[model samples]
Target chain A: MTVQISDTARPAAAGTSSGRSLRNLTYRPEAGALIGTLGVFVFFAIFGGTHFLASAGTAAWLNVAAELGIIALPVGLLMIAGELDLSVGSVLAASSMTMAIVSGYWGAPMILGIVLALGVGVTAGALNGLIVTRTNVPSFVVTLATLFGMAGLTLGLSRVITGTTSVALNPDPGSKAVFGTLIAGQFEVAILWWIVVALGVGWMLQMTKYGNWILAVGGDKESARAAGIPTNRLKIALYTGSGFGAALVGVIQTILYNGAQVANGQSFVFNSIIAVVVGGVLLTGGYGSVVGIVFGTLTFAIVNQGIYYTGWNSDWASFILGVLILAAVLMNNTFRRLALSHAPRSGKKA
Target chain B: MTQPLLRLTDVGKSFVGTNALEDISLEVHAGQVLCLLGDNGAGKSTLIKILSGFHAPTSGTIEVDGQPVVFKSPRDVSAYGIATVHQFGGTFQLMSVGRSFFVGVEPTKGWGPFKRFDKGLAGEIAVREMQSLGITRVTDGKRLVGSLSGGERQALAIARAVYFGANILILDEPTAALGVKEATHVLRIIMQARAKGVAVIFVTHNVLHAMMVGDHFAVLIHGRKADDFHKGERTREQITDLMAGGEAMADLEAELAALEASAGSTGRS
Candidate 1:
């Protein structure tokens, strides 16, 4: 064994140490997302001028980012685990309505409304997990079913209970301070929540056994099961996490806007996915980083909000976004290829 | 002679009405290589699944070290120290070597919420283990599993199983997809594991490869054990013929000869 090591491993180690470090940075999973984020930020900073670069302008995009980031982080985890939760949009709407109707329409304690709202999200996620695991159906189809079904359920329930499609909420002081308040008269309190979520998730994915299981499950479910990972349980937990994230976002929206709308969260479904994909997470699963998702969210928000600051037509924002997504994906694919093709040269020399 | 490390008695598995496996018994001893040889649809996968606890036996009992145990899931089988390395090494392609090496059981440092996967320790141990198995090219455990060659990936899987203290290692078609040199490397690794007293169940249809490392051999034909013997008891021809379901190979030769003879006669006429 010692002979083999000296013969095969030494040359490769010696050859690559000098230049590989720089190349390694480019090959990292988050490299594309980081570059994309910076590219978009610069683009907006140029066109939107001093206003886009200033404090209030930063707050505008930061607020949008914080809300989308919270949802995108868990959604990113689900994608890494090789599943999709399309119903996050509906879960957000449902939870927002649940909290609004309970606290606003029924005049119940704020705490109860908050609990029930989050509960609705967790339950919906668990249900998605159960249906996917128990049946051989793909999670895409299962979650898609929940997306429409939950939307109808939330809309129907809201109309029945409040007798209106929209309901108003006047949050209690404590809840307002925690969930709804704007910091410095500009930045949304949700930004703090986004930071906490990012740190927690980044640690879990990079440091925990659960993170390893999620990657394994995403890479190959059958192989993961053979390795003794509880694939079903892990997947269910991921779905649940995404549900909770959406619900939290819903509650935040309800508190911030002082009202709930059945149609409020539909944009989040694709938007969160867009952020995650732009962040360099593989849409097919089994590969991504939390850092990438964060960068992706920031990039998306900058482009989304920065367009309004520019004198150009707002309609072209989506066209720019469409191009950016393609470019980021192409860049990610190239890095992925580089990563896969990496091999120690000693084997070839031998 | 002594108690087999693992023993199966009258194990049978049926899906609906069709029996994928029948009442077949087998024993595997520590420090020995048991080669399960079969052709397509010969119930090799079914038996492997049953042993790995992916499926429960419809009938029969399994004994590990002379004690009866029921395997309801892969986790249960693993608790008995049986590690299965599926074809393609079963390593997550997108994960780093150290991470994939410790999947489902990461080594942690610190305590409680502050505790985290010990990346440095994990990488060191993974590289050390793979090198010990003669996979010297994998000096850096931070490399992606997808980047490794087929043989190196197999080494990684075997190294992981060994590092985790698995007493019985089941390799499902480990060499089927490998080149000649890579297959030799895997066969050598199998011997090294056996030298460490790990019982190995090497499953494959390649008679030559099986004959290289197998101490004990079992040929399965249509869900039944056609023959079971120690090495040298049967030649390559006999093993090959048996794997083809006893008379199938012989019948094929006869049919080919008759067809040639008839063609000659018709041309003359």
Candidate 2:
């Protein structure tokens, strides 16, 4: 509910830098993300030459981007709900283990493995949510605690039971075609999953009752509580969604490589957050979109792998990513101010 | 068909170390607006919260339509036709006007996880509710509430309350921070709500607005009632005085007595 109230109609329309108040131009978050996207593409296309546009190269970068983007979608939704899930990595590991132990180890049916994996993810998410909702601690601290606890459990249980940090799986032929196969040689079916999820999440964020409540909780918890939104329940769902996101990623990776690793998905913790924010989500809560997150993830992937295609040092990838995130965020804030300058100005008695 | 919509008998509330309300009693009959006025730090908020079932008073009981009830949450209050519209309007601004209007109890279709909000039904209801409140200008249910004025948000809050079958409403400072125009708009909606036979307990410091809309006025000073009056017994000046602390009146009495003694001494000289 932090609406900027400024009437931009009365401003002097002079085109001078000093005369043109930043308020006159309505810079939307979508606009900023779009512009950043174009900027990154032009920069890479000029420097990286044919490889940046090569279908094989595009697919390779998109493969990584698809994985990151899938998780980012839910993470963005969670951020908008004013909550976080530090335990996503553990959730991913646990989900993969469920699939590995159930199908590969126990020789169970593929459907059972899929169901067990999803169930494990949902349960872990619910537990995190229940603990956070019922407790008075900040979600940052609470989720962080769950993150460490689940990681320990994932590792201990893996070593004691699976007896190794990783598990190799060869899916049944039926399962491979249905859930694991690559489509069109280049695009992983996971990309389609990512795309469908993005569309669905985006629509939900914009159109649904739950979507509105998510923004409300993120914008102000107390106000959402007063509105009788069942903010606690909504937050728990958000956590559960985050867990579900991680689990999906785990399933995709397990299918892609036909294996499960306890150490996988650690990088997602920060990468997903950056993708969400770069896409225009406010860390403070209640702003941004699914499309923006998708663009942000693509931009990151392009920068990460694109650096190598340009024959530059791969180490420069991290540095470039840091810059891109910072720059996109700065522009996003600027756009927010611009978009808001036209609103009805407050503090005026008249 | 009509028993008193809501009743509070010997309702008392205690905080960690202090009694905010002690043996306080009030009744909200249908179609009546009761304004609860108080200075800062008064127990108006506490009283509102209790009526909304946020905090069960340490001692005392409450009744709705002559039926004694114990409420564990605000949802329980809703079952009894009581809803609270706090100062913030308690809405999601990024959400569409329609969605914010029908949160929690949204009309859903399909089955299980695939269930989606019935947008057409929601929009129709939102439009009708808002129109009933005479907010006819807002036609686009898809518009985000962040675009609405402060008064519009308040009216929407009230409309949402009535739409949800709340017969008794507890509004917390509906116009405390609004401008003249927005506040006037809210007053208009309050009048419409009154016409609908809803019992409203309005909590505010604006005696003028209270006099305009409220059928009864109760003033709380330092967690206690300084005075209670109907439209005839209270004035703008009287309510303002009680709100400034009872010490102001005592100081005025002492000054008047000292002046009388000086006048007498001068007459003798």
Candidate 3:
């Protein structure tokens, strides 16, 4: 009986051997994303020439990565918990407009604008959570509705209040230093915020009990609930977290660029998901890591920004993004298969 | 001699106008296995759900330790030391064994917001408990539950319940999907749980499997208790006949023989 059971269960067990060794490196959840990052980096570094490796060139993509990473980390968590938030783009635009109108146009305190802008995001996110949990509608549809709704609201409000779709904000020096300033004259301060978000989210997903709950909920909601895990509450919290993330990015972009535009953030909705997928987080959920997302963000940023340095037509950016996303997913799938196939040489039979 | 850990008196359940269970009376005692036997659609599921607190009995009373209790939900029943391991072991496939073992009631270290899952303690306890259940192959707590065999998963689930202070373990068709060998392992786990003084409600239709570990038996047929007996009071044939609605099978066998005889005549002609 033991032998028969082992024979049946061995294939699944083969790749999941828990010993720490060189062979086990292939089985690390982030292994695929890491390889993809390195592969993309080396490809771009060769084609993008000396300037691409230069500080100014590096900062261009790093800045983009930083903003996207902030949103992608929480988005990744949502995906891992088996949901999607498509309203992040609108949340960004809405928050940006809120800050601009409050602080930039009305001359209110910068802190008040910041707080209100984030408040808009929190409200939108909480609504998203409430609707998703209460109505049993798929989050994809719910967030999609919010996406269009917020976009319209941001555009209409900005037009009515500021008399234009654009509003300018010249933040106080202290606020600029913290939220928008460029470090070393090139790197956006947002990069630091990105790292902090990554670390904090990483700790939450890997070390906390909440992380376990997220994984459980994503893995199998019925089983999780049967085991007495509060699957509904966990999901709502994750949705809200994703909302807060998008809003934070909106605030950062508004401060850094010194203006807000109603139409500026649509690309982020898909881009953050791209970064997350490239980071080796499964779209089906129940699997992923923050480190993988960071790497994915970097990969995406390079592919996005490297085109300018390569002197290619910017028109091909979307085309290349499509190709890169496909290639990254394929690569991740292969690596996952390899990692889950079987352990090498040091054979510990099940 | 002692008060049964759980007692259901004249329990009945109906879902929307359809009766699922009727007049089910049973008692389970610590250190004993009470096997619930029935064929498909025989109200075994409804009875187990009521017992496990997934469904409330529409009539009669459930007494825990001789005191009547109402279980509003599975969590409420679980609070009374009753844990039900479903058919597939009710485990998360993607999660690590340690995580799955301590899932809902995880051990935490630290204070307030800073408190986190104690992975080391969880892993150690999971491995130790599983090993105690004779699942020695699960050496690494980091192993995914998906990789464990059917029998091993059952053992893990049972061990988790035992470790979490589950005094009343209700196993729902645990060996139904397992192979012969795997079934043996599960049977052993049931006996082990019994030995540890846990009152077990083993639910299965397989007479041999039930006979292997059952001290008390209750057979449900068409939502009603057909027979309730001690282990030695009923023979295998008599129990099997009871499950088939007593003499209904004999009538069917005679009909089948007549049909066969007609077919044979037709072929000869």
Candidate 4:
């Protein structure tokens, strides 16, 4: 006789009913970022010229932070999804080129150029996602390949069409204020864009179904899939978000300086990942906060620009940054372990 | 009656030209617990892979409710109200309890871009589902799965399946490495599932447990069916003998007699 199976399709029995609260935070990375931001501010204000504490100085560093923060947020989300995007730099270059070709060369409407730039970024991200998912390759290898390929393509294509490495952008007065204007009408409008992006993406990550899925996939992909999560889709979306962020930064660069260059937006790759980690996200995934990443961005920017204020050898800036990444990461790891160790029990509702 | 909820007719699987399961047939009915017994590598894994839709049998027909059907992917098996709760009870360790419970199928609020996780509703559902399984009390309802015990983890997984509307539950050695206390907790949950009128397929090597709780016991020998018995049809000794090799015992008797004769004549001893 054949084996007969019954339709035992019952709802998954209720899950862990333990009511545990969030674990203790003896040393919060959040606090560290706050303290670090202020510490650097104080160091620069007291040691450097009186101009260091001026609004313009604050504006300059904040602007720098705003640009980097926008990219870091999406990169942080991607890291949370257990993936990486080395192609972000290339995406920036490609998006800027798309905008330059459309608006500056072809004389297309600024809106179309903007949409096309975003579209190019999305397409690049989708391609990266597809290659990674279909080939079952590590995202590092996949995105790195895209990184070089996109960079080469951007340089080759731009040189072919423009006969130069840079594109000059001159937006209308209305577009100029929106696409290029900064705070107090002098800082890069990109700074405001970074804020808007930070808020929007922050909300998406902290308050949406997508955020939960991202965390699940990052924490444990197999479990996520068993739980019915579309993990691959979540990863793809994260990469896309990163590409979008990078692309937006490209547009801002174009508007802020009224020019686009292939060499621009290069430091963002490592710097954003650094911001994510410094912000309290573990490179291994499944942890971190948008607020933390924002603080990380500020910490990074202040240290970067603050050194200039202190009149320290600007070349030593690189050395100082290397130390900060190490120091911040170590501190964050220690605090993380403490929090997790003290974290509420498994049976307790959180 | 209605071609049991799931039917496996002469299912076989092979790996790299080696047979894993051969001529295996099994069936489970609603409100029934089928205990699958086998030695390690008795083709239990092969049979499970086929049943769980992780792999297809080289030759077999899987009939659902009297109708032959094919599952192209795990998603296909899920559509037939079948779910496999692996031994480890795969749950996101990094996510909150409420998040893990309603992971891929979270309750949503608002519409469009305004759409968001209904954390409150998800919490309510998680609590309701847990309580239904007799876990009745959870204070914060926000703990991570990593914080739960091994037994509690299993309970949560079962609850997730039951709450998600799975009718057929295939548990793979649910209490394999568990302590006595933890094993009992799992057994209690199994009984809870049966009480819910759900068909449970309990795969384990624990004979005492099989004899104690299994409504039907089916012995699998080397990926082939050796015998099928109702709960009271066979004693534990008989089941153990059959599992360890009834044929080998007969061969051993002849060999022992021959050896005894040789020893006496040779006088070496």
Candidate 5:
């Protein structure tokens, strides 16, 4: 029996000889997204000229990318774990409205307004988590319900309390400096917050045990449970974290623009997902990276903002965005297939 | 005699007015492989689930080392050194071998907020443990589980169970999906695990494979133990006949003969 086992093991050892060859760099998961990003950047650089590359011109999209990236990070993690958060758009609008109503309309302290705004997001997020877990509904459907539900509530409340659908805020210098100000008069302070969020979430997903739990839960929840991982709690935590991301962006928007609107923030619902997918995060979950998502966000931002700098018809932005996303995803699929097919070097044995 | 590592007496399980398993009794001693053989719907799955703590037996008691123990959950059973490796090896395909090996109980380094999964330690241990199990190709701990062949996945799962201190290992059809060579690899791993004093309950329908490594055998038919014997007490043919439920095979043969006779008469007409 021992000799037979050794003989059977020999084929595997022979196969391993070629398995040691370094996988082609382009076959990495993020390779497609990286190439797509560069392709778009170079295209725009030539067309948009130095103005597009200049600091102020760069911030045009950087500011947009910052807010979207912040939301996308958590959304990307949720996607990687095999869930969705469509309510982020509503959460963004609702939180923004909450801050405006409390500080601008009700004359509350700016700090209180900020707290209330973020609190609303956390509460909504927790509720979303609870309903999905308890009722066993697809998160896409549950969050969709909350998206409209929160949007309606925000509009109704804003009208009832402030007598309008929009409200303005005048934040104190301290609150504005931290959450609302643009660093160096060009970059939005939200960029700093985006970096902070990326680092924190990136570390959590890559370096910690919790990260593995998320991957396991997303990969196969039954298997994860069988392995003794707390699949449900991990999912709920992801939802809550997503909510926090959306809400933080809400607070930033409210403070940066000094106003809020009930109709605003709807675009973020799909945009963040687009950025995450373009970044190489699988929509089905269980595979992705923070760095991939970051690049995806930048790629998305560049395309969305670069069109304006290119002197093209602004109406074609949506069309162009659609094409870019499909191309990026196709490129990603090709690279993944290449990576999975890469064989071993076949001479070495353990 | 030494106490068996695990013993189930008159174990029965039912769900929603259906008895999935009934009056099953078995015992597995340390360093022994008890091959549980059955056909489809013969309650092999139910019996394994009850043993692994995924389901509670509606009747009978489970004893661990001579003490009656009730398992409320898989976690509870795992705490008592019981582990179950399902048919597909229960591995996360997209994860690295090291990450999959140390998934639920990962080792951490650094202080309070700085703590993180110790990848180096996990990789080193995963490769070492797998090599010890005779899987020489899985030297790179970073290889994705999906990239592994079916046999290698089974070896990794079994190695993981033994390394994590599983005294009673329940493998549910670990060799069912593999080709002949891969099945041999899995059988070898089971033998290695048994030599290390782990009690193994190997569930399969393959009489030949079961006869290869099983020291004690139990044939379950319609949720009941139809036969129980030690090595040398039963021949491979008898075990296969038993798994086919002796009299039922005759009934099946009769039904098939009847159908053939009817077809022949019609064709003649």
Candidate 6:
């Protein structure tokens, strides 16, 4: 009897080992994101005409994607760890205003202004982490509170310090070259920064011990705690990383534009989330990938910019985005179900 | 007559005004399967909690290899090579098998500034451990743990504990939800662990499963040790009656007999 049972199990295990990579693709976490990216690129490449295929047209979407990708990557990480940071928008605005007021209005050194701006983001993020971990409050609520609170602080402080909501900046040549200058006078240098952030974050999530802890925490917090993982600390660090990412984007925009406004970053609040979800991340947490988030950012950017090249009606951009979100989520749901139900095919029922 | 792997003497725990457990004493040596039997609300979970280091005893002492030690946390207990596997294997369902196996203590390779988790090593080890536990269907450690059957998950948890050098294994109703075949597989794995010299604490409400592998048995009833004996000292019916709470079994039998007699006469009429 035991021999029969063992014999029956062997073929199934061996079956999955051979020629299964193609079948396995349907179960991969980034499968939906990959498909969505390709589908949208094809959609835009055809309807967007010759100009959309040009280098400048490509840079248009890439620039938007680069900025949003930086914020989306960490936000994706936060989401995978089972938390949400609704305050990235506020962090961005606050950081932008801080840099402008410090260097543009107060005439401080450019480096000092940059450091202080990033510091504001880290502080806001750490505060979000501390409040969410130390108390029973959900991260969504805590970050929402931070979002409004930081927005008020930035707006009020900008008005008080510069006597206006907007501040103009004349960045030092060095700072401009690293953070603001365009490549070949076409693409923002932020693209390079975005690539670096993605590589680092990807390494952290895929090849590090902490990545395992993050997934375990998101999968089941109680079990992760029982396994002796420092759940709270991991969550705090993820939130802080996201804070830094948002602030980096703020600094990039402030330098690139040569000015900052109190209301410059509010669009990022929903845009970053849209990019993350459209990339195939689970909104509730525990199943996502850096590759998927990147693809998601690109998909959002292509749709956002490609519509402008179509020259139909810019008003249709939001409509397409709304349909895209529903489609991506539904696609992700189908793949996740495939993943969960993919048990080995033994003779007996599992 | 070597020292028992784990010994509990006069261990008691209190919560507010109620004693969850009282003066519970038990001992098990390496290579032994000690089955803890009890009814619902019989302090079985409390005892398991105290043993697993989730709760500090309010009184008495727990000794390991003859040295009394206090376990203020699960980490402290794990350091003593005491591991617990709850129902459904206490596993992360969404994580891959290799990843779940090494959640807290991941294996790494390469030099500093380039250190990375050794995915191949982790997967190989996880797969080898599961195969050793007779889980032949799970050949790929990259498979998500959620994809494993209930029996396979339990085997994975046991394999993990053994791989991590657990001297004593505390399983909380490991076979409660398993079918006959799967339950038998888990029982076989438990025996395999016993053969390898790891002390096993098998907690269950099922009397038959307790008899199959249990070398020694202890029954808890209402925060107290009601019985303790070696194998063959009791019959299956006697064990079941005790687990159902002593006199309730006889009362239930008599009530059933009376109801049958009345129904038979009414049906004939």
Give Cα-based local distance difference scores for all models: 0.88, 0.77, 0.86, 0.77, 0.86, 0.88
* TM-score of predicted chain A against the true chain A, for each candidate: 0.92, 0.88, 0.91, 0.88, 0.91, 0.92
As a TM-score, model 5 comes out at 0.92
Model 6 misplaced regions, further than 4 Å = A1-21, A343-350, B253-269
Evaluated on CA atoms against the true complex, candidate 3 attains a DockQ of 0.38
Q: What are the runs in model 1 whose C-alpha is more than 4 Å off?
A: A1-22, A344-350, B254-269
The regions of model 5 sitting more than 4 angstroms off are: A1-27, A341-350, B251-269
lDDT by residue (tens digit), candidate 3, A141-259: 99999999989988998999989999999998888988899988988998888877887898888888888988888877877787788878887888888888889998988998998
- Candidate 2 per-residue lDDT, tens place, A49-88, comes to 8877676666676777788887888888888887777788
Q: Just chain B of model 1: what TM-score?
A: 0.94
Report the lDDT tens digits of candidate 1 across residue range A207-278.
Answer: 778888888888888888777788898888999999999999999999999989998799899999999999
Q: Mind giving the per-residue lDDT tens digits that candidate 5 earns over A208-227?
A: 99988888888888878878
Estimate, for each residue in B1-269, the C-alpha lDDT of model 4 and write its tens digit.
54587778888887887888877777888878889988787877777777777888888788877789887777778778887877877777656668878878888899998898887777667767776776644433455666556776687788888887788888888888788887887888888888887778888888877776688888988888999988899999899888878778779888988899899988866
What lDDT is obtained when candidate 5 is compared to the true structure? Answer: 0.86
- Note each model's CA RMSD in angstroms: 7.6, 8.6, 7.1, 10.3, 8.5, 7.7
Q: How far off is residue B222 in model 4, in Å? A: 2.6
lDDT of 5 at B152: 87
Give the per-residue lDDT digits (tens) of candidate 6, residues B1-269: 78899999999999999999999999989999999999889999999999888888999999999999999898889999999999899998878899999988899998786788887899889999998988888977888898888999999999999999998999999999999999999999999999989999999999999999999999999899999999999999888888888688789889989899898988862
Candidate 4 local lDDT, residue A88: 91
Cα deviation in Å at residue A77, candidate 2? 2.6
Model 2 residue runs over 4 Å out of place are A1-31, A97-119, A160-164, A171-173, A178-181, A199-209, A219-230, A333-350, B1-3, B108-115, B120-128, B131-137, B249-269
Report residue B242 deviation for candidate 1 (angstroms). Answer: 2.9
Clashing pairs in 2: A5-A343, A5-A344, A5-A345, A6-A343, A6-A344, A6-A345
